[model samples]
Target: MSIETWLAFFVACWLISLSPGAGAVASMASGMNYGFARGYWNALGLQLALVLQIVIVAAGVGALLATSALAFALIKWFGVLYLLYLAIRQWRAPAQTMTLEHRPIGRPLSLVLRGFVINFSNPKAIIFILAVLPQFLDPGRPMLMQYLIMAVTMVAVDLVVMAGYTGLAAKALRLLNSPQQQRLLNRSFGVMFGVAAGLLATVRRV
Candidate 1:
Protein backbone atom coordinates (compact mmCIF):
# COMPACT_ATOMS: atom_id res chain seq x y z
CA MET A 1 0.00 0.00 0.00
CA SER A 2 1.19 3.53 -0.79
CA ILE A 3 1.48 6.21 1.95
CA GLU A 4 -1.67 7.99 0.79
CA THR A 5 -3.67 4.80 0.64
CA TRP A 6 -2.44 3.75 4.08
CA LEU A 7 -3.33 7.16 5.51
CA ALA A 8 -6.87 6.92 4.24
CA PHE A 9 -7.21 3.42 5.63
CA PHE A 10 -5.82 4.70 8.93
CA VAL A 11 -8.57 7.30 9.11
CA ALA A 12 -11.13 4.67 8.25
CA CYS A 13 -9.79 2.47 11.02
CA TRP A 14 -10.26 5.27 13.54
CA LEU A 15 -13.83 5.79 12.39
CA ILE A 16 -14.62 2.10 12.58
CA SER A 17 -13.10 1.80 16.04
CA LEU A 18 -14.98 4.82 17.29
CA SER A 19 -18.37 3.62 16.09
CA PRO A 20 -20.87 2.44 18.71
CA GLY A 21 -21.48 -1.29 18.49
CA ALA A 22 -21.52 -4.50 20.46
CA GLY A 23 -17.76 -4.28 20.93
CA ALA A 24 -18.04 -0.85 22.55
CA VAL A 25 -20.89 -2.07 24.75
CA ALA A 26 -18.86 -5.10 25.77
CA SER A 27 -15.85 -2.99 26.70
CA MET A 28 -17.89 -0.59 28.79
CA ALA A 29 -19.78 -3.41 30.48
CA SER A 30 -16.54 -5.17 31.37
CA GLY A 31 -15.07 -1.97 32.74
CA MET A 32 -18.18 -1.31 34.80
CA ASN A 33 -18.01 -4.80 36.23
CA TYR A 34 -14.27 -5.32 36.62
CA GLY A 35 -12.48 -2.00 36.35
CA PHE A 36 -9.95 -0.94 33.71
CA ALA A 37 -7.05 -3.21 34.75
CA ARG A 38 -9.06 -6.43 34.53
CA GLY A 39 -11.54 -5.38 31.87
CA TYR A 40 -8.89 -4.53 29.29
CA TRP A 41 -8.49 -8.25 28.63
CA ASN A 42 -11.76 -8.03 26.74
CA ALA A 43 -10.17 -5.61 24.33
CA LEU A 44 -7.41 -8.14 23.60
CA GLY A 45 -10.04 -10.70 22.63
CA LEU A 46 -11.69 -8.17 20.33
CA GLN A 47 -8.34 -7.67 18.57
CA LEU A 48 -7.88 -11.41 18.15
CA ALA A 49 -11.26 -11.75 16.45
CA LEU A 50 -10.47 -8.71 14.32
CA VAL A 51 -7.19 -10.24 13.17
CA LEU A 52 -8.98 -13.47 12.28
CA GLN A 53 -11.57 -11.55 10.25
CA ILE A 54 -8.85 -9.75 8.31
CA VAL A 55 -7.14 -13.05 7.63
CA ILE A 56 -10.40 -14.60 6.43
CA VAL A 57 -11.03 -11.67 4.11
CA ALA A 58 -7.46 -11.71 2.77
CA ALA A 59 -7.80 -15.45 2.08
CA GLY A 60 -10.94 -14.75 -0.01
CA VAL A 61 -13.30 -16.65 2.32
CA GLY A 62 -15.13 -13.41 2.97
CA ALA A 63 -16.35 -13.43 -0.62
CA LEU A 64 -17.88 -16.84 -0.06
CA LEU A 65 -19.55 -15.64 3.09
CA ALA A 66 -20.85 -12.58 1.31
CA THR A 67 -22.44 -14.75 -1.33
CA SER A 68 -23.93 -17.33 1.06
CA ALA A 69 -27.29 -16.17 2.33
CA LEU A 70 -27.67 -19.14 4.64
CA ALA A 71 -24.31 -18.50 6.22
CA PHE A 72 -25.06 -14.82 6.69
CA ALA A 73 -28.51 -15.44 8.20
CA LEU A 74 -27.18 -18.06 10.60
CA ILE A 75 -24.46 -15.79 11.86
CA LYS A 76 -26.80 -12.82 12.10
CA TRP A 77 -29.36 -14.72 14.17
CA PHE A 78 -26.62 -16.06 16.41
CA GLY A 79 -25.38 -12.55 17.03
CA VAL A 80 -28.85 -11.31 17.80
CA LEU A 81 -29.54 -14.11 20.26
CA TYR A 82 -26.18 -13.63 21.96
CA LEU A 83 -26.81 -9.94 22.42
CA LEU A 84 -30.20 -10.67 23.93
CA TYR A 85 -28.53 -13.05 26.34
CA LEU A 86 -26.10 -10.34 27.32
CA ALA A 87 -28.94 -7.91 27.86
CA ILE A 88 -30.72 -10.26 30.22
CA ARG A 89 -27.47 -10.92 32.07
CA GLN A 90 -26.88 -7.23 32.45
CA TRP A 91 -30.42 -6.67 33.65
CA ARG A 92 -30.07 -9.31 36.30
CA ALA A 93 -26.59 -8.29 37.38
CA PRO A 94 -26.20 -7.54 41.08
CA ALA A 95 -26.29 -3.91 42.00
CA GLN A 96 -23.52 -3.23 44.47
CA THR A 97 -20.74 -0.72 44.91
CA MET A 98 -17.47 -2.08 43.54
CA THR A 99 -14.41 -1.61 45.67
CA LEU A 100 -10.85 -2.83 45.23
CA GLU A 101 -11.07 -4.75 48.48
CA HIS A 102 -14.41 -6.47 47.90
CA ARG A 103 -15.05 -6.28 44.16
CA PRO A 104 -15.60 -9.57 42.37
CA ILE A 105 -12.80 -9.76 39.86
CA GLY A 106 -13.74 -12.02 36.98
CA ARG A 107 -11.23 -14.41 35.44
CA PRO A 108 -9.37 -12.70 32.62
CA LEU A 109 -9.73 -15.67 30.32
CA SER A 110 -13.49 -15.70 30.76
CA LEU A 111 -13.64 -12.00 30.05
CA VAL A 112 -11.50 -12.50 26.98
CA LEU A 113 -13.74 -15.30 25.80
CA ARG A 114 -16.80 -13.14 26.30
CA GLY A 115 -15.25 -10.39 24.24
CA PHE A 116 -14.22 -12.84 21.52
CA VAL A 117 -17.74 -14.24 21.29
CA ILE A 118 -19.25 -10.77 21.15
CA ASN A 119 -17.13 -9.70 18.18
CA PHE A 120 -16.97 -13.02 16.40
CA SER A 121 -20.73 -13.55 16.37
CA ASN A 122 -21.30 -10.24 14.63
CA PRO A 123 -21.34 -11.13 10.91
CA LYS A 124 -21.68 -7.47 10.09
CA ALA A 125 -18.11 -6.82 11.16
CA ILE A 126 -16.62 -9.34 8.75
CA ILE A 127 -18.94 -8.14 6.01
CA PHE A 128 -17.90 -4.55 6.64
CA ILE A 129 -14.25 -5.57 6.50
CA LEU A 130 -14.83 -7.43 3.24
CA ALA A 131 -16.53 -4.38 1.77
CA VAL A 132 -14.02 -1.76 2.90
CA LEU A 133 -10.53 -3.29 3.18
CA PRO A 134 -10.25 -4.21 -0.51
CA GLN A 135 -10.65 -0.59 -1.53
CA PHE A 136 -7.22 0.20 -0.14
CA LEU A 137 -5.42 -2.61 -1.90
CA ASP A 138 -3.13 -2.30 -4.93
CA PRO A 139 -3.54 -5.20 -7.30
CA GLY A 140 0.03 -4.70 -8.59
CA ARG A 141 1.55 -5.07 -5.09
CA PRO A 142 1.97 -8.14 -2.90
CA MET A 143 -1.39 -8.70 -1.17
CA LEU A 144 -0.07 -10.16 2.05
CA MET A 145 1.92 -7.06 3.00
CA GLN A 146 -1.04 -4.76 2.51
CA TYR A 147 -3.29 -6.99 4.60
CA LEU A 148 -0.71 -7.18 7.36
CA ILE A 149 -0.42 -3.40 7.49
CA MET A 150 -4.20 -3.02 7.64
CA ALA A 151 -4.62 -5.69 10.31
CA VAL A 152 -2.04 -4.01 12.49
CA THR A 153 -3.48 -0.55 11.95
CA MET A 154 -7.02 -1.68 12.73
CA VAL A 155 -6.07 -3.61 15.85
CA ALA A 156 -3.96 -0.77 17.23
CA VAL A 157 -6.67 1.81 16.67
CA ASP A 158 -9.38 -0.38 18.17
CA LEU A 159 -7.30 -1.10 21.25
CA VAL A 160 -6.93 2.59 21.97
CA VAL A 161 -10.63 3.24 21.41
CA MET A 162 -11.71 0.33 23.60
CA ALA A 163 -9.32 1.44 26.33
CA GLY A 164 -10.97 4.83 26.35
CA TYR A 165 -14.40 3.24 26.58
CA THR A 166 -13.27 0.92 29.36
CA GLY A 167 -11.57 3.67 31.30
CA LEU A 168 -14.55 5.95 31.04
CA ALA A 169 -16.88 3.30 32.40
CA ALA A 170 -14.46 2.44 35.20
CA LYS A 171 -14.28 6.08 36.17
CA ALA A 172 -18.05 6.28 36.15
CA LEU A 173 -18.19 3.40 38.60
CA ARG A 174 -16.90 5.67 41.34
CA LEU A 175 -19.95 7.89 41.20
CA LEU A 176 -22.25 4.93 41.66
CA ASN A 177 -21.92 4.60 45.40
CA SER A 178 -25.44 3.43 46.16
CA PRO A 179 -27.11 0.20 45.13
CA GLN A 180 -29.93 2.14 43.55
CA GLN A 181 -27.54 4.11 41.41
CA GLN A 182 -25.71 0.97 40.41
CA ARG A 183 -28.96 -0.76 39.57
CA LEU A 184 -29.97 2.13 37.37
CA LEU A 185 -26.66 2.04 35.57
CA ASN A 186 -26.90 -1.70 35.05
CA ARG A 187 -30.40 -1.45 33.58
CA SER A 188 -29.31 1.36 31.30
CA PHE A 189 -26.53 -0.80 29.94
CA GLY A 190 -29.03 -3.61 29.54
CA VAL A 191 -31.19 -1.32 27.45
CA MET A 192 -28.21 -0.36 25.35
CA PHE A 193 -27.39 -4.00 24.73
CA GLY A 194 -30.97 -4.68 23.71
CA VAL A 195 -30.86 -1.73 21.37
CA ALA A 196 -27.66 -3.02 19.83
CA ALA A 197 -29.26 -6.40 19.26
CA GLY A 198 -32.25 -4.77 17.61
CA LEU A 199 -29.99 -2.83 15.27
CA LEU A 200 -27.96 -5.93 14.39
CA ALA A 201 -31.17 -7.77 13.59
CA THR A 202 -32.03 -5.12 11.03
CA VAL A 203 -28.77 -5.46 9.10
CA ARG A 204 -29.10 -6.99 5.62
CA ARG A 205 -26.49 -8.18 3.15
CA VAL A 206 -25.20 -5.24 1.14
Candidate 2:
Protein backbone atom coordinates (compact mmCIF):
# COMPACT_ATOMS: atom_id res chain seq x y z
CA MET A 1 0.00 0.00 0.00
CA SER A 2 1.06 3.58 -0.66
CA ILE A 3 1.78 5.95 2.23
CA GLU A 4 -1.45 7.78 1.51
CA THR A 5 -3.42 4.56 1.57
CA TRP A 6 -1.92 3.52 4.91
CA LEU A 7 -2.59 6.91 6.44
CA ALA A 8 -6.21 6.82 5.35
CA PHE A 9 -6.70 3.32 6.66
CA PHE A 10 -5.26 4.29 10.04
CA VAL A 11 -7.50 7.32 10.29
CA ALA A 12 -10.59 5.34 9.34
CA CYS A 13 -9.95 2.62 11.86
CA TRP A 14 -9.07 5.13 14.57
CA LEU A 15 -12.33 6.97 14.05
CA ILE A 16 -14.32 3.76 14.15
CA SER A 17 -12.62 2.59 17.33
CA LEU A 18 -13.33 5.95 18.90
CA SER A 19 -17.00 5.21 18.61
CA PRO A 20 -18.49 4.15 21.98
CA GLY A 21 -19.49 0.50 21.87
CA ALA A 22 -19.02 -2.77 23.73
CA GLY A 23 -15.25 -2.50 23.58
CA ALA A 24 -15.46 0.94 25.13
CA VAL A 25 -17.87 -0.36 27.74
CA ALA A 26 -15.48 -3.15 28.61
CA SER A 27 -12.57 -0.74 28.81
CA MET A 28 -14.47 1.61 31.08
CA ALA A 29 -15.51 -1.31 33.27
CA SER A 30 -11.96 -2.52 33.57
CA GLY A 31 -10.63 0.93 34.33
CA MET A 32 -13.28 1.73 36.91
CA ASN A 33 -13.05 -1.58 38.78
CA TYR A 34 -9.48 -2.74 38.35
CA GLY A 35 -7.53 0.38 37.40
CA PHE A 36 -5.20 0.79 34.40
CA ALA A 37 -3.53 -2.62 34.64
CA ARG A 38 -6.67 -4.58 33.86
CA GLY A 39 -7.95 -1.83 31.61
CA TYR A 40 -4.86 -2.32 29.42
CA TRP A 41 -5.70 -6.00 29.05
CA ASN A 42 -9.27 -5.15 28.18
CA ALA A 43 -7.98 -2.89 25.45
CA LEU A 44 -5.68 -5.66 24.26
CA GLY A 45 -8.57 -8.06 24.07
CA LEU A 46 -10.53 -5.63 21.92
CA GLN A 47 -7.63 -5.18 19.50
CA LEU A 48 -7.07 -8.93 19.30
CA ALA A 49 -10.70 -9.42 18.36
CA LEU A 50 -10.27 -6.85 15.59
CA VAL A 51 -7.41 -8.83 14.09
CA LEU A 52 -9.49 -11.99 13.96
CA GLN A 53 -12.45 -10.10 12.58
CA ILE A 54 -10.38 -8.54 9.79
CA VAL A 55 -8.82 -11.86 8.86
CA ILE A 56 -12.20 -13.55 8.72
CA VAL A 57 -13.66 -10.83 6.54
CA ALA A 58 -10.67 -10.50 4.21
CA ALA A 59 -10.47 -14.20 3.42
CA GLY A 60 -14.02 -14.32 2.06
CA VAL A 61 -15.27 -16.19 5.12
CA GLY A 62 -17.54 -13.25 5.80
CA ALA A 63 -18.94 -13.35 2.29
CA LEU A 64 -19.80 -16.98 2.77
CA LEU A 65 -21.44 -16.30 6.11
CA ALA A 66 -23.34 -13.38 4.70
CA THR A 67 -24.77 -15.59 1.97
CA SER A 68 -26.08 -18.21 4.37
CA ALA A 69 -29.22 -16.85 6.02
CA LEU A 70 -29.45 -19.58 8.62
CA ALA A 71 -25.83 -19.16 9.61
CA PHE A 72 -26.20 -15.39 9.83
CA ALA A 73 -29.39 -15.55 11.84
CA LEU A 74 -27.96 -18.12 14.19
CA ILE A 75 -24.89 -16.04 14.87
CA LYS A 76 -26.92 -12.86 15.24
CA TRP A 77 -29.27 -14.42 17.74
CA PHE A 78 -26.38 -15.88 19.67
CA GLY A 79 -24.81 -12.43 19.84
CA VAL A 80 -27.99 -10.95 21.20
CA LEU A 81 -28.33 -13.66 23.80
CA TYR A 82 -24.74 -13.23 24.91
CA LEU A 83 -25.18 -9.50 25.36
CA LEU A 84 -28.30 -10.07 27.41
CA TYR A 85 -26.43 -12.50 29.61
CA LEU A 86 -23.67 -9.98 30.20
CA ALA A 87 -26.25 -7.34 31.05
CA ILE A 88 -27.77 -9.54 33.69
CA ARG A 89 -24.44 -10.48 35.24
CA GLN A 90 -23.25 -6.91 35.53
CA TRP A 91 -26.60 -5.87 36.97
CA ARG A 92 -26.51 -8.57 39.63
CA ALA A 93 -22.87 -8.45 40.67
CA PRO A 94 -22.01 -6.09 43.51
CA ALA A 95 -19.34 -3.44 43.05
CA GLN A 96 -15.72 -4.45 43.63
CA THR A 97 -12.80 -2.29 44.73
CA MET A 98 -9.33 -2.66 43.34
CA THR A 99 -6.34 -2.91 45.66
CA LEU A 100 -2.64 -3.59 45.35
CA GLU A 101 -3.17 -6.72 47.44
CA HIS A 102 -6.30 -8.25 45.89
CA ARG A 103 -7.27 -9.39 42.41
CA PRO A 104 -10.51 -10.07 40.61
CA ILE A 105 -11.40 -13.75 40.94
CA GLY A 106 -11.76 -15.25 37.51
CA ARG A 107 -9.76 -17.93 35.72
CA PRO A 108 -7.54 -16.57 32.95
CA LEU A 109 -9.18 -18.75 30.32
CA SER A 110 -12.64 -17.69 31.43
CA LEU A 111 -11.66 -14.02 31.32
CA VAL A 112 -10.33 -14.25 27.78
CA LEU A 113 -13.28 -16.39 26.72
CA ARG A 114 -15.71 -13.76 27.93
CA GLY A 115 -13.73 -11.13 26.06
CA PHE A 116 -13.89 -13.17 22.86
CA VAL A 117 -17.62 -13.78 23.18
CA ILE A 118 -18.25 -10.10 23.93
CA ASN A 119 -16.46 -9.17 20.70
CA PHE A 120 -16.89 -12.15 18.33
CA SER A 121 -20.60 -12.53 18.85
CA ASN A 122 -21.20 -9.00 17.63
CA PRO A 123 -22.02 -9.32 13.88
CA LYS A 124 -21.65 -5.57 13.56
CA ALA A 125 -17.92 -6.08 13.97
CA ILE A 126 -17.76 -8.27 10.88
CA ILE A 127 -19.90 -5.84 8.98
CA PHE A 128 -17.73 -2.95 10.09
CA ILE A 129 -14.64 -4.73 8.78
CA LEU A 130 -16.31 -5.50 5.47
CA ALA A 131 -17.57 -1.98 4.99
CA VAL A 132 -14.54 -0.07 6.24
CA LEU A 133 -11.67 -2.11 4.79
CA PRO A 134 -12.37 -2.73 1.11
CA GLN A 135 -12.75 0.93 0.39
CA PHE A 136 -8.99 1.27 0.71
CA LEU A 137 -7.81 -2.15 -0.47
CA ASP A 138 -5.43 -2.06 -3.39
CA PRO A 139 -7.05 -3.86 -6.29
CA GLY A 140 -3.71 -4.27 -8.05
CA ARG A 141 -2.08 -5.99 -5.04
CA PRO A 142 -2.27 -9.62 -3.91
CA MET A 143 -5.49 -9.88 -1.92
CA LEU A 144 -4.11 -11.61 1.17
CA MET A 145 -1.12 -9.27 1.43
CA GLN A 146 -3.39 -6.28 1.02
CA TYR A 147 -5.58 -7.55 3.82
CA LEU A 148 -2.62 -8.19 6.09
CA ILE A 149 -1.45 -4.63 5.64
CA MET A 150 -4.92 -3.36 6.33
CA ALA A 151 -5.30 -5.51 9.43
CA VAL A 152 -2.00 -4.35 10.89
CA THR A 153 -2.85 -0.74 10.25
CA MET A 154 -6.30 -1.11 11.76
CA VAL A 155 -5.23 -2.99 14.88
CA ALA A 156 -2.43 -0.58 15.62
CA VAL A 157 -4.82 2.34 15.62
CA ASP A 158 -7.38 0.54 17.72
CA LEU A 159 -4.83 -0.41 20.37
CA VAL A 160 -3.48 3.11 20.76
CA VAL A 161 -6.92 4.72 20.86
CA MET A 162 -8.29 2.18 23.31
CA ALA A 163 -5.27 2.60 25.55
CA GLY A 164 -6.01 6.28 25.61
CA TYR A 165 -9.54 5.57 26.79
CA THR A 166 -8.23 3.30 29.52
CA GLY A 167 -5.81 5.94 30.70
CA LEU A 168 -8.47 8.62 30.96
CA ALA A 169 -10.75 6.33 32.89
CA ALA A 170 -7.90 5.35 35.21
CA LYS A 171 -7.38 9.00 36.06
CA ALA A 172 -10.93 9.06 37.32
CA LEU A 173 -10.17 6.07 39.53
CA ARG A 174 -7.42 7.97 41.26
CA LEU A 175 -9.94 10.41 42.74
CA LEU A 176 -11.79 7.97 44.96
CA ASN A 177 -10.12 7.46 48.36
CA SER A 178 -12.67 5.07 49.87
CA PRO A 179 -13.96 1.59 49.08
CA GLN A 180 -17.56 2.76 49.30
CA GLN A 181 -17.00 5.28 46.53
CA GLN A 182 -15.26 2.58 44.54
CA ARG A 183 -18.22 0.32 45.03
CA LEU A 184 -20.53 3.02 43.77
CA LEU A 185 -18.28 3.52 40.77
CA ASN A 186 -18.52 -0.18 40.11
CA ARG A 187 -22.29 -0.08 40.12
CA SER A 188 -22.26 2.91 37.80
CA PHE A 189 -20.08 0.94 35.38
CA GLY A 190 -22.42 -1.99 35.69
CA VAL A 191 -25.33 0.20 34.69
CA MET A 192 -23.37 1.43 31.70
CA PHE A 193 -22.65 -2.14 30.64
CA GLY A 194 -26.30 -3.08 30.92
CA VAL A 195 -27.27 -0.11 28.80
CA ALA A 196 -24.73 -0.98 26.16
CA ALA A 197 -25.96 -4.56 26.03
CA GLY A 198 -29.55 -3.46 25.76
CA LEU A 199 -28.63 -1.14 22.91
CA LEU A 200 -26.87 -3.93 21.05
CA ALA A 201 -29.77 -6.35 21.43
CA THR A 202 -32.28 -3.90 20.08
CA VAL A 203 -30.32 -2.51 17.13
CA ARG A 204 -31.97 -3.83 13.95
CA ARG A 205 -29.81 -5.47 11.35
CA VAL A 206 -29.56 -3.75 8.04
Candidate 3:
Protein backbone atom coordinates (compact mmCIF):
# COMPACT_ATOMS: atom_id res chain seq x y z
CA MET A 1 0.00 0.00 0.00
CA SER A 2 1.15 3.50 -0.74
CA ILE A 3 1.43 5.96 2.12
CA GLU A 4 -1.66 7.81 0.91
CA THR A 5 -3.70 4.64 0.60
CA TRP A 6 -2.59 3.45 4.01
CA LEU A 7 -3.53 6.80 5.48
CA ALA A 8 -7.02 6.56 4.05
CA PHE A 9 -7.42 3.05 5.38
CA PHE A 10 -6.24 4.25 8.77
CA VAL A 11 -8.90 6.92 8.77
CA ALA A 12 -11.52 4.40 7.80
CA CYS A 13 -10.36 2.13 10.59
CA TRP A 14 -10.98 4.88 13.13
CA LEU A 15 -14.56 5.33 11.94
CA ILE A 16 -15.18 1.60 11.86
CA SER A 17 -13.81 1.10 15.36
CA LEU A 18 -15.76 4.00 16.75
CA SER A 19 -19.07 2.72 15.41
CA PRO A 20 -21.31 1.26 18.09
CA GLY A 21 -21.72 -2.53 17.76
CA ALA A 22 -21.65 -5.69 19.77
CA GLY A 23 -17.88 -5.42 20.21
CA ALA A 24 -18.12 -1.87 21.51
CA VAL A 25 -20.99 -2.74 23.81
CA ALA A 26 -19.09 -5.72 25.17
CA SER A 27 -15.99 -3.63 25.76
CA MET A 28 -17.90 -1.09 27.79
CA ALA A 29 -19.74 -3.78 29.72
CA SER A 30 -16.52 -5.57 30.55
CA GLY A 31 -14.93 -2.37 31.72
CA MET A 32 -17.91 -1.55 33.88
CA ASN A 33 -18.03 -5.01 35.42
CA TYR A 34 -14.36 -6.11 35.39
CA GLY A 35 -12.33 -2.89 35.64
CA PHE A 36 -9.93 -1.67 32.95
CA ALA A 37 -7.01 -3.91 33.83
CA ARG A 38 -9.09 -7.04 33.55
CA GLY A 39 -11.30 -5.59 30.86
CA TYR A 40 -8.27 -5.16 28.61
CA TRP A 41 -8.01 -8.91 28.19
CA ASN A 42 -11.36 -8.80 26.41
CA ALA A 43 -10.03 -6.07 24.15
CA LEU A 44 -7.06 -8.27 23.28
CA GLY A 45 -9.37 -11.14 22.50
CA LEU A 46 -11.36 -8.84 20.24
CA GLN A 47 -8.13 -8.08 18.38
CA LEU A 48 -7.58 -11.78 17.97
CA ALA A 49 -11.04 -12.08 16.49
CA LEU A 50 -10.26 -9.24 14.12
CA VAL A 51 -7.09 -11.03 13.10
CA LEU A 52 -9.13 -14.10 12.24
CA GLN A 53 -11.53 -12.08 10.13
CA ILE A 54 -8.68 -10.35 8.30
CA VAL A 55 -7.07 -13.68 7.61
CA ILE A 56 -10.29 -14.98 6.16
CA VAL A 57 -10.51 -11.90 4.00
CA ALA A 58 -6.90 -12.16 2.89
CA ALA A 59 -7.36 -15.81 2.01
CA GLY A 60 -10.37 -14.93 -0.19
CA VAL A 61 -12.82 -17.02 1.86
CA GLY A 62 -14.42 -13.82 3.00
CA ALA A 63 -15.73 -13.22 -0.50
CA LEU A 64 -17.37 -16.60 -0.57
CA LEU A 65 -18.82 -16.07 2.88
CA ALA A 66 -20.18 -12.72 1.90
CA THR A 67 -21.68 -13.89 -1.38
CA SER A 68 -23.10 -17.16 -0.21
CA ALA A 69 -26.55 -16.39 1.08
CA LEU A 70 -26.79 -19.62 3.07
CA ALA A 71 -23.49 -19.02 4.83
CA PHE A 72 -24.23 -15.37 5.40
CA ALA A 73 -27.70 -16.02 6.76
CA LEU A 74 -26.45 -18.74 9.10
CA ILE A 75 -23.77 -16.56 10.58
CA LYS A 76 -26.12 -13.60 10.79
CA TRP A 77 -28.67 -15.49 12.79
CA PHE A 78 -25.97 -16.87 15.06
CA GLY A 79 -24.74 -13.38 15.76
CA VAL A 80 -28.24 -12.14 16.46
CA LEU A 81 -28.96 -15.00 18.84
CA TYR A 82 -25.63 -14.64 20.60
CA LEU A 83 -26.15 -10.93 21.10
CA LEU A 84 -29.56 -11.62 22.58
CA TYR A 85 -27.99 -14.10 24.96
CA LEU A 86 -25.47 -11.48 26.03
CA ALA A 87 -28.23 -8.94 26.52
CA ILE A 88 -30.10 -11.26 28.84
CA ARG A 89 -26.94 -12.04 30.78
CA GLN A 90 -26.16 -8.38 31.19
CA TRP A 91 -29.67 -7.62 32.32
CA ARG A 92 -29.64 -10.36 34.92
CA ALA A 93 -26.17 -9.70 36.33
CA PRO A 94 -26.07 -8.68 39.98
CA ALA A 95 -25.06 -5.10 40.77
CA GLN A 96 -21.58 -4.81 42.27
CA THR A 97 -18.33 -2.90 42.12
CA MET A 98 -15.36 -4.33 40.26
CA THR A 99 -11.85 -4.74 41.72
CA LEU A 100 -8.63 -6.55 40.90
CA GLU A 101 -9.47 -9.71 42.82
CA HIS A 102 -13.23 -9.44 42.73
CA ARG A 103 -13.86 -11.38 39.52
CA PRO A 104 -15.22 -14.86 39.69
CA ILE A 105 -12.94 -17.85 39.32
CA GLY A 106 -12.11 -18.46 35.62
CA ARG A 107 -13.74 -15.15 34.69
CA PRO A 108 -10.66 -14.02 32.75
CA LEU A 109 -10.95 -16.83 30.26
CA SER A 110 -14.68 -16.31 30.13
CA LEU A 111 -14.27 -12.64 29.34
CA VAL A 112 -11.76 -13.34 26.59
CA LEU A 113 -13.94 -16.06 25.13
CA ARG A 114 -16.95 -13.80 25.29
CA GLY A 115 -15.14 -11.12 23.33
CA PHE A 116 -13.90 -13.59 20.74
CA VAL A 117 -17.31 -15.16 20.27
CA ILE A 118 -19.04 -11.82 19.90
CA ASN A 119 -16.67 -10.67 17.16
CA PHE A 120 -16.41 -14.00 15.43
CA SER A 121 -20.13 -14.46 15.15
CA ASN A 122 -20.62 -11.26 13.21
CA PRO A 123 -20.72 -12.22 9.53
CA LYS A 124 -20.88 -8.56 8.64
CA ALA A 125 -17.30 -8.16 9.83
CA ILE A 126 -15.91 -10.37 7.09
CA ILE A 127 -18.23 -8.82 4.54
CA PHE A 128 -17.29 -5.30 5.57
CA ILE A 129 -13.62 -6.14 5.31
CA LEU A 130 -14.07 -7.74 1.94
CA ALA A 131 -15.97 -4.71 0.72
CA VAL A 132 -13.54 -2.12 2.08
CA LEU A 133 -9.99 -3.51 2.34
CA PRO A 134 -9.54 -4.20 -1.35
CA GLN A 135 -10.08 -0.58 -2.36
CA PHE A 136 -6.73 0.42 -0.83
CA LEU A 137 -4.65 -2.37 -2.33
CA ASP A 138 -1.82 -1.43 -4.68
CA PRO A 139 -1.39 -3.84 -7.57
CA GLY A 140 2.22 -2.71 -7.96
CA ARG A 141 3.15 -3.44 -4.35
CA PRO A 142 3.44 -6.71 -2.48
CA MET A 143 -0.06 -7.84 -1.57
CA LEU A 144 1.13 -9.48 1.63
CA MET A 145 2.72 -6.26 2.81
CA GLN A 146 -0.42 -4.32 2.00
CA TYR A 147 -2.55 -6.77 3.94
CA LEU A 148 -0.18 -6.59 6.88
CA ILE A 149 -0.32 -2.81 6.98
CA MET A 150 -4.09 -2.79 6.78
CA ALA A 151 -4.41 -5.43 9.49
CA VAL A 152 -2.03 -3.58 11.80
CA THR A 153 -3.82 -0.31 11.26
CA MET A 154 -7.20 -1.85 12.00
CA VAL A 155 -6.00 -3.68 15.11
CA ALA A 156 -4.23 -0.61 16.45
CA VAL A 157 -7.21 1.65 15.93
CA ASP A 158 -9.64 -0.87 17.39
CA LEU A 159 -7.44 -1.48 20.43
CA VAL A 160 -7.33 2.19 21.30
CA VAL A 161 -11.05 2.70 20.67
CA MET A 162 -12.05 -0.36 22.66
CA ALA A 163 -9.80 0.69 25.52
CA GLY A 164 -11.41 4.10 25.54
CA TYR A 165 -14.86 2.56 25.69
CA THR A 166 -13.79 0.27 28.49
CA GLY A 167 -12.09 3.04 30.46
CA LEU A 168 -15.03 5.42 30.08
CA ALA A 169 -17.49 2.83 31.33
CA ALA A 170 -15.22 1.91 34.23
CA LYS A 171 -14.99 5.53 35.24
CA ALA A 172 -18.73 6.03 34.99
CA LEU A 173 -19.30 2.97 37.13
CA ARG A 174 -17.21 4.50 39.87
CA LEU A 175 -20.00 6.93 40.69
CA LEU A 176 -22.68 4.23 40.60
CA ASN A 177 -22.23 3.08 44.16
CA SER A 178 -25.76 1.96 44.85
CA PRO A 179 -27.20 -1.32 43.63
CA GLN A 180 -30.14 0.47 42.01
CA GLN A 181 -27.86 2.75 40.02
CA GLN A 182 -25.62 -0.12 38.93
CA ARG A 183 -28.61 -2.18 37.90
CA LEU A 184 -29.90 0.69 35.82
CA LEU A 185 -26.56 1.10 34.11
CA ASN A 186 -26.36 -2.60 33.44
CA ARG A 187 -29.82 -2.66 31.92
CA SER A 188 -28.95 0.19 29.64
CA PHE A 189 -26.02 -1.74 28.26
CA GLY A 190 -28.27 -4.74 27.89
CA VAL A 191 -30.64 -2.62 25.85
CA MET A 192 -27.76 -1.46 23.70
CA PHE A 193 -26.81 -5.04 23.01
CA GLY A 194 -30.35 -5.82 21.97
CA VAL A 195 -30.32 -2.88 19.61
CA ALA A 196 -27.05 -4.01 18.14
CA ALA A 197 -28.52 -7.46 17.60
CA GLY A 198 -31.48 -5.98 15.81
CA LEU A 199 -29.20 -4.02 13.57
CA LEU A 200 -27.03 -7.01 12.85
CA ALA A 201 -30.03 -9.12 11.94
CA THR A 202 -31.12 -6.53 9.44
CA VAL A 203 -27.77 -6.21 7.66
CA ARG A 204 -27.75 -7.06 3.96
CA ARG A 205 -24.86 -8.18 1.80
CA VAL A 206 -23.70 -5.56 -0.64
In candidate 1 the C-alpha lDDT for residue 97 amounts to 70
List pairs with backbone clashes in candidate 1.
none
- The local distance difference test score of each candidate is 0.91, 0.71, 0.87
lDDT of 2 by residue, 56-101 (tens): 8977897776667676667767876776676667656664455544
lDDT-wise, the better of 1 and 2 is: 1
CA deviation > 4 Å runs, candidate 3? 97-106
Task: Name the best candidate (by lDDT).
Answer: 1
Off by over 4 Å in 1: none
**Candidate 2 residue pairs in clash (backbone atoms < 3 Å):** none
Q: Compose the digit string of candidate 3's lDDT tens values, residues 108-156.
A: 7888888998999889899889989999998898988889889989999
**Would you list the rank order by TM-score, best first?**
1, 3, 2
* Highest-TM-score candidate: 1
Candidate 2: lDDT over CA atoms? Answer: 0.71
Distance (Å) between predicted and true CA of 62, model 1? 0.4
